[model samples]
Target chain A: MTEEAPAPEPRPAPGLPPGPFAGPAPAAAPRQHLIVVRVRLPAHLRTLVQLEKETERGPGHGTASGPGHGTGSEVTLELDSPGTQSSLLDALETRYPVLIGTIRDPRTRVRRPFIRFFACEEDLSHEPPDSDLPAPVLAGTEPFVILGAMAGG
Target chain B: MSTIRVLVGTRKGAFILNADASRKSWEVNGPFFGGWEIYHVNASPVDPSRLYASQSNGWFGQLVQRSDDGGTTWQPVGNQFPYAGVPGTHQWYDGTPHPWEFARVWHLEPSLSDPDTVYAGVEDAALFRSSDAGTTWEEVSGLRRHDSGSSWQPGAGGMCLHTIVLDPVDPERIYTAISAAGVFRSDDAGTTWKPVNRGLSSESIPAPEAEVGHCVHRIAMHPSRPDVLFMQKHWDVMRTDDCGESWREVSGDLPSDFGFTIDVHAHEPETIYVVPIKSDSEHYPPDGRLRVYRSRTGGDEWEALSDGLPQRDCYVNVLRDAMAVDSLDPCGIYFGTTGGQVYASANAGDSWAPIVRDLPAVLSVEVQTLP
Candidate 1:
């Protein structure tokens, strides 16, 4: 999974935009956005999401809520060229309809109970539930992983 | 080589901090599974060889872990679940121990009367006792039946029974502090329960009794004097002499009174220790000047004991269950931080030394001194 370290990109502060803000959404696409999924998924739910191998469609088309909606059995991840927390999670959910209560807060963007977010080599636990993730991670060129934080002792 | 064994419990898994007596340093290995947020880790006193860990796992509910050879290898007491009626789940919650209602075991204390007798504090909020180590459990009917249920309210961490204080000498006389709940006593071995909170405050608008919402964060009684007590409360640090009949603030002398966890000397009943965790600020430990404060003559005076610590901005929150004192002669005081740091104090609370750093965020810290 090594690809020359993505050209020494500048790491932006978490929840903040990269470079100067031009407007609501940046025009430039993230140069290094790539999605990698790790799963210990249960068998029963596996059949509900119709499994698909690698199919690179544009943005949210691959998310849990995408146009292909109920067709895919795999969890999908998307980075809006350069990404935002809102877009990343939304993209994944758009494609995987069964992932309703898996990630974000069921009622809010806050992380769900027993669910935690880690990136930029730090636990982004203190960040506001709705804020954008660090820009470097949005680009997704680096490794982005989403897994369950199982309970019990 | 003779070594010092350290048991660390976490919301996701448990880790073992091991090292030689030389204290040259240590090693950490874990993420031990069984589901359940492990809030308490006790290295057995009778058998330094065995370790006990309790947590909210699933319908297999409460979890119990034992390390036979000083924490190197671990075995989960899975079958003991239905016996205690605790919940156990294999899935992750908030990426932490799955918190089950009918049973969420938060505290585990080994009985001094019978080494096999172990205690588990659950969420439906009952104290279940296991006589054959963690192999089997029974709800201590006396204390469990008398619980004041109507008053119990769910805290952000969930309303539960926390600190269980066992009399090292008299097992029959035990005390447990309930969160948002009050302090309870079982003098006749949980056969009967009564509020030990005299001076402790309650949420009662008309007349506050130790009924509920007085929420005790931790209850520390002098190891030698069961009558004398000290508590790091939900909002303050307090002390009492007549067995919780009344209390007084012993925390006005610090930066801020909002913190978790407190300790005392294994030898001297008068010597005490408390970590100054930031209550009103974003940072846990004020500016990283996280010195462990000690009060030799009660909580009358507090001297900063962070001589060898970092002088930079360090906001580390030390949990109520993360600080302790080993049974060494000069009395060694030890603690770890949310920032993944562990420090040691050889001379009680005088100065400090960093034993290890850059470990995972420390959830619980337990040390065993080998004879």
Candidate 2:
């Protein structure tokens, strides 16, 4: 959970450093901790997002023994800074704008009735929006899962 | 070769039925955008290949879909319809002031000369237009911000602007109708409007001869004779020859005057069609028979065309926008029913046959004549 500043550019040798005209130290570009997280979307959301699957596997088709118990065609998403559920959703919607109101209400920001959120084999549905994601999910060892609940027979 | 396309909007999705000028056998295409309510689907008059659909659901809100190659493919368009300035209040169902809220689009009207320009009539009673081919929408605030708007009230179906009619002769004139609010006409291209319910009398309203609050269900006008309008009210069929300045009851001799849909023949300006329901409370036809009455002499006399329609134990309601007419030589007449049946008459109501029997209850039907 510690922030990692980006490595500073190698300083030019004494004579190579562009003399007195060198510009003010470029404000160490705000260290944006980019994290790549795997996302497992439900069947309905996968269709709504309309992302072409890289593999032939369908929803819940992957290994179920890992920290992320269920599997599907996983999409890798890149996020910056603290990767909370809210931030992750913001990033997902930014990439797939058509899903603005599909998984969450546009006005209320509440999850849809038949949708569930999970990670590390635990239901993160009720977790606070700003809470940090699970360690396994943050480390890319597990996927942030979006599952459609089994409602009717 | 000339072709005819019938766009049907149902409770679940939209279906496009295409056939040649012969109007004999149709090739059914789809239940496109399945599982979503498609309220209206209309083709652009200038560009037959351009189409627009109003897709919505209770859970996810409203969405506008546009197709460049007719209905072959579609992509979501803008759904943000913010009212201009402060959205004031209108009368709610109980006669109390209620804040204006954005509801689903009830009708989509593409421009006559420009495919990119379109208009939308939405619930909570507002009109919006998009000049960028449905990519963005801005409300034509003049209609909703009129002086009499505060007195506007919701009908049983909610205060929805459901009908839009543009004059073919004069591009400056526009007409729109709202349930429980009667009819309104704009002379300066929707920039301003005035109530045109002068002669409309409804017993359900507080005043029978009031300027507004008549609960108009639908209105139709043949492009050739734009001034002459046909209206189907909650209990009466009306005719207005003076650009809706005044109207006269033409509910003549029919099984019942209570009905929803009304449309004019494509070639014949005087010829009109209406499906009379039993009563306001009972939406089905009388004696459990389905009939579509045609009046060739404009309104006084009528004939029930039931040759190919059901006669016994068939009780189904036809919504206000479920009827349309194609502009072919023979001129086909079409309408869909609550029982999920779409019937078409090639020879103008002389006889009819079902196109597709099982669809979610049809909400609207529109036709395009293509060459």
lDDT of each: 0.60, 0.82
The worst-scoring run of ten residues by lDDT in candidate 1 chain B lies at B83-92
TM-score of 2: 0.85
Model 2 segments beyond 4 Å from truth?
A: A1-32, A37-45, A52-59, A62-75, A101-153
lDDT of each residue in B1-371, candidate 2, tens digit only: 88999999988789999889888899888988786788899989999999999987654557888999989999888877787888889998888899888778999999998999999999889999999999989999899988988899988778899999988899989999998898999999999999999888889887899987889999999998888999999999999999999899998998899999999999999999999999999989999999999999888789999989999999999999999999997989999998889999999999999989998889999999998
Candidate 2 local Cα displacement, residue B324, angstroms: 0.7
Q: What DockQ does model 2 achieve?
A: 0.09
Best by TM-score: 2
RMSD of each: 13.6, 11.7
Candidate 2: tens digits of C-alpha lDDT, residues A1-153: 001123322222111111122211134423368776777775445655564542575444443333222234556677775677888888777877777766676655777554567765566777777767765666666667776554322
